[model samples]
Target chain A: MTAPEPAYVAVDWGTSSFRLWLIGRDGDVLAERRSGEGMTTAARTGFAEVLESHLAAVSAPAGLPVLICGMAGAKQGWVEAGYLDTPAALADIPAAAVRIPGAAADIRILPGLAQRDAAAPDVMRGEETQLLGAAAQLGEGDHLVCMPGTHSKWVRLSGGKVAGFSTFMTGELFEAIARNTILSHAIAEAGPISGDNAAFRTAVTRMVANPALATSQLFSVRAGSLIAGLSPVDAKARLSGTLIGLEIAGALSLVAEGTPVALVVSGGLGTLYKDALAAAGISPAVIDADAAVRNGLAAGARALWSL
Target chain B: MTAPEPAYVAVDWGTSSFRLWLIGRDGDVLAERRSGEGMTTAARTGFAEVLESHLAAVSAPAGLPVLICGMAGAKQGWVEAGYLDTPAALADIPAAAVRIPGAAADIRILPGLAQRDAAAPDVMRGEETQLLGAAAQLGEGDHLVCMPGTHSKWVRLSGGKVAGFSTFMTGELFEAIARNTILSHAIAEAGPISGDNAAFRTAVTRMVANPALATSQLFSVRAGSLIAGLSPVDAKARLSGTLIGLEIAGALSLVAEGTPVALVVSGGLGTLYKDALAAAGISPAVIDADAAVRNGLAAGARALWSL
Candidate 1:
């Protein structure tokens, strides 16, 4: 494949992951690099070095403006790009990007979104970019966008404005409970839980029906393994379903009925969440997270440098 | 504390704790022994040896019938005492106790309670004894009993029969989530969560109102700490409240409206749960767990040996 001359560099630097794409003037990907040197690793290894290595690996031209997002903007990251408090507008995000001073290349890290309400103080670093990229597909009107990951974000978007959002530690809690609690014994050797698993669907439905019974349902995983002869795979699936189902139910509780839902996700988690949402009787418009973040970075570039 | 002549020996052999009580024929305490040589330790250091040492410590009469409960009856314990299926009679439990064979002493372990339904399979070993002891205080009629611990059991008792029970992994989940997840950073050096904390009460109220939003509430603890100037104590309290509140909500859902609730708890957890129950709008009849287990063993002995 012949590589097009890179117009600019787009980076999505998350907590534990880093992805960079060289974009052509025509909006086509010229070259790409992905690594585990995200904000956490980059903070220790020097963020500039990590970015420069990835840029060099992609053979990007000198003076190409690099636009970044995610934890790179976190306080402990390369630069504290800070946050744009909610009810902030998406169009105003690029202008808020904090440039890395004294750097050889033109590099800018986009600020995150923060809801500073006393009741639900929340912050999201890299996902604002994804929301920006996927915002066009989501269109106008009321939207409840579900972004599933370590800390899942359920954002309320009206028109082009991010009204507010809630973060659920669904993925992180699942890992902690499964690995550190008695349920670990039940699912220790199990493989990845499939979205199509019957146990998975049932658990999701149950949580949505009576979310108060969530922790009790978690114990039932171990009990089921002991008395009901639940296999390790099914046990694992139940754990996954309960957490994901709780997330869906929580998100649903905040929004108005019949509001359009969009899921910005990639890979296996995408399928799992899709199935979970389906179990909860909602079909969301799906957006590939990879393209969304890249598109978000490109949007930032276009606004910042007219690329 | 005048010591009476030993009529029989009662033992609560739990997972990580061992307690032995010498009871008089008139139901008076004779001598007592407690140790960490519970089923787990005894299973390794020899169950017979552990029992013999405790018996020696109490100076029990040789061949005195010993009544045991909890994990000592599990398959991995000294003897497999099995389980009494629900809706089981409290009177029938003593009859099902498995006597340890080939021992100089007549030692019997009480059977646990099991609900083997496909939907909510559950089991309880030690807490069944607590329920048995607390049943008299609970009196006749429908009762919902909350026994908070490592595996918190919510029992549904109709008259002297146990209809069913559900276990919530509240304590275990709290430890796992606090120590194994990102929230650890928020509550790294925090003290134990108290029932009196406003944060605790507020969390309980929130969960009761909308249990589906439970996991989201968990993330708020971390978010609150990071952005809302939440102290470590409040962070810990919030985490504790979320789990406990979820348990309360789950327990309430299973019982009839306004069923008289009883709390069978012993230590600090008792106070925390009492506050949680109060927050959920229920004033439970509190029963000291220590006395309840001993009474259970005494009741079992009376039924078995007519002591």
Candidate 2:
């Protein structure tokens, strides 16, 4: 347990975030680094340099084989890791990892999942790793996994195989609507929304009952403030609830009745989504998203490098 | 049929627009004026002076009575012409017009309609006047009138009485999502969306079939661009269709199956909505919103003054 010597590096490089962890041979973190130098920034300032700088910061061992996930593998990233099409096996991800060229140390970026159906052609870059990790705890079964973030991913897994998934612009839409639309005036001074807030619960119930009225319900936030004396906090809560609730309804509609749902999330978002799901009478098993991603990277490392 | 002298002025003063028509005793427009001096602008430059300038521009006679509608009657406008609660008669709207006090002329602003139910509190300002105007053509039956704009109002009218309504944040949301969200990248170079576009029609049909997946459908625009090589035009069309379709679905849900639907719209928005409704298996009666507002104002003027 004496920190087992640094064996490999695991990185989750997203759109606007970069996280790197130096993992020991025992599959435990020996050192870690996080920065805003994600794909967008690295693409401008050199992806290889960004990786090298972070590696140097943690005093990594020479020639450490790094396994990366998320946007870093996108077409616009360092090297396009490409996508492993649907009905894909979680076991196949490590094999599809595209290796970065001209690097002294070994570095491989994991492939994303893509649903190539014409009607609902979809793609996910990083969440597939989280899904792989969470699947370990989820075990083999018919499971509905909701990984909430900027682009919330709702995945359906059947017997350790990926069936299909839908990404809801829940978090991003909430920001755009609140800040860019007229709802800004209604929720200008509001603080964060919690699960127990009555407005949040009510909004969730309303969306769940009749999600077709989602946009109409959004306008009610403004009208409620203008005429019905709805408070700013309540207005924000209502907006959050409506978006989250709409997502829940959509995800629920795709899955069969009585199917077990699980929420893989981290930090404050975890509590908020837990409350939102609860509003829809769903109590999903919670999984730490941070740990899930780390565990996913570890699994990839073990599969690839035999660490 | 000799041209009658000007008797009164009818105005539709909205949030960011102002339109005035000097009407003759025979219900003809003697002189018309339009400006950007809506409530928002007039509140800064002076509502009375803006009215005086517009009236002077149109050579309105001295002491000419004026009937106004829209935001000019809001709490922060020229005067607070409070809302007439729902189940209100169109004929009674003129009686409820709050007269501007101490003016040389008899100036009045018509009251908006408010559905004061605690569950779904809603309000409509200027559209009530359009409803008043369109009511003449609508006659005596159940009608679902849709006035599409920044805040699209869907009215449930029965026997010339304002029953209830819902406002969908369709237009505003389209702009917000298109400009502020990641979908912006997908639709950056796209031109305006037309009704006949394949992507637009298909999106409308999808939403009408499954409104709960609205946000997910939104994300598909981006995914479609990335994976399916969807054009920028199609991306924009899909966004527009999803919102329009959602609105139609919500409006249809509130009324009976066979209730006649009408589109009270002006300019390019008319064709888009007509096409959207068609996608929902609805052929709404089209009413020119411009004429509707004028007729509504004239109706109010005739009721208020014995010209």
Candidate 3:
């Protein structure tokens, strides 16, 4: 078997990092490339050059169709692919792909999802593609999808249509609070927090019990370390847990009671969020976020070029 | 009708500020001096020298005993005054003042307050003195006192005894999030938020309604600006309002409903907290924090040296 002929290239280009996967006709990942050349860098160095250089390294065939997702489709990115307003159908995302004007290949960027509610206006870029792929496994009925990241997005999906979602500034807030605030002295190294940590689970439990005391609980990190000699690791864990717990509590509030939930995540944060959810009495159906995005790009490719 | 003779010198030396007041025999402020020579600065410039220069400028009588509070008493301050454990009487705080050794003048610094519960161990330095003076005016009964600052402190005063207190990282979190997170783009300049702003009151109301949605609401500040044309002023207001409202919610949760609350703030944050509290449906009696600390210092001086 001569390694199945290459079909297309799928890219998840985020703010500060770029990832591209070459796919075979059988939907297998033929070759892959990862880089720090995200939108911020590509916008300066030229998006077309960045993409072509990666493609050349992977030895892609000339003029092969490429499906792009994430910030690369932003107004400031390679080519503007505006947002598809909710409640948008996941299947229709590919048809809305914005094609590059003068690119050599059939390069198209996927549109993001925008919730235009007057009260809670929100937006998402690459996560739309991830959700589109993840939604394939999540068939029928309603589901609360958790896509944890720097800004954790909780989406409400109904029958393959995007209803609405909320973005929680949990991870970003955790980092800022840990680095810039007085709590910096408590959690010294500012290391990665563990899910199995008792302080982590306890923080989640406390937030679920009374989410109002969040900032106060944050103060407890400093105070606990000062008065109670709380270990640095526990301090970091509690800090991480408080933000994650608050995120879960806020997300759960928007959904109907007992709505099936799916956690689409990959790596360490996956475990951290899982522990936080368990601490909040939630056991989510897990999906690999990495695979979800790849599958999403594949779906887009299949629609755009019938590859 | 001759000029009043100076009796004692009162100082409220905080982390980043230095304030000195010359008090007459009749409890009048004869002369005042303020500088940036707080604990963080005084430690390098010599706390004794910093105090003496201000005292000499005010022509404070030689050997006139000095009453100091705030970070001047921290271990990292001029000299560690330590902390008075909870259930401590406000009247008893004066007796615990730690004397500054090897000083030309008879100088003393007051002790701070510490809540040592296992789950919620907390500490406070300068605010304890403010609480001491504020308690005198409160005159018995349980009062939830709000002292808004970089770290807002809510003291539970019960019958003139320091019951317990909580410190919220509200003000600090607001600054950090506004400057460090992605929301910074939404709230340009991050100017001081107004209490009278509609967005501010709305944010406070929302937090009071569902404190769980804090981080999500924070994201709304950015999304609101991105999709809904939310103004920078309104964006900043929402950010400030969200943190302040969460603080009020947390403080209220720790107390019995309808506890007589008092706002002990000095500057702009006073109006902000008042508006936020009103939005939360509570009208707290107000106290000027600057005066509270001065009054606390006077009380300490009278108790210490019968001035």
**Tens digit of per-residue lDDT, candidate 3, span B169-269:** 98899889989999999998656667999999999988998999999999999999988999999999998999999999999999999999999998777
Quality of candidate 2 docking, DockQ: 0.84
CA lDDT of B115 in candidate 1? Answer: 93
Higher-DockQ candidate of 1 and 2: 1
lDDT of 2: 0.92
Q: What is candidate 1's lDDT per residue for A44-120, written digit by digit as tens? A: 89998999898889888888899999999998899899999999999999999999999888899999998898768
Error of 3 at A171 (Å): 1.5
Candidate 2 residues A1-307, lDDT tens each?
5547888999999999999999987887899999999999999999999999999999998898999999999989999999999988888888899998888888999999998877677899999999888889999989999999899999999998889999999999999999999899999989888989999999999989999999988998888898899999999999999999999999999999989999999999999999999889999999999999999998899998877
lDDT of 3 at A231: 92
* Per-candidate local distance difference test: 0.91, 0.92, 0.92
State in Å the error of residue B173, model 2: 0.4
- Candidates 1 and 2: which is better by lDDT? 2
Best-to-worst order by DockQ is 3, 1, 2
Candidate 3: segments with Cα more than 4 A from true spot: A1-3
Clashes of each: 1, 0, 0
**Native-contact fraction for each model?**
0.90, 0.82, 0.90
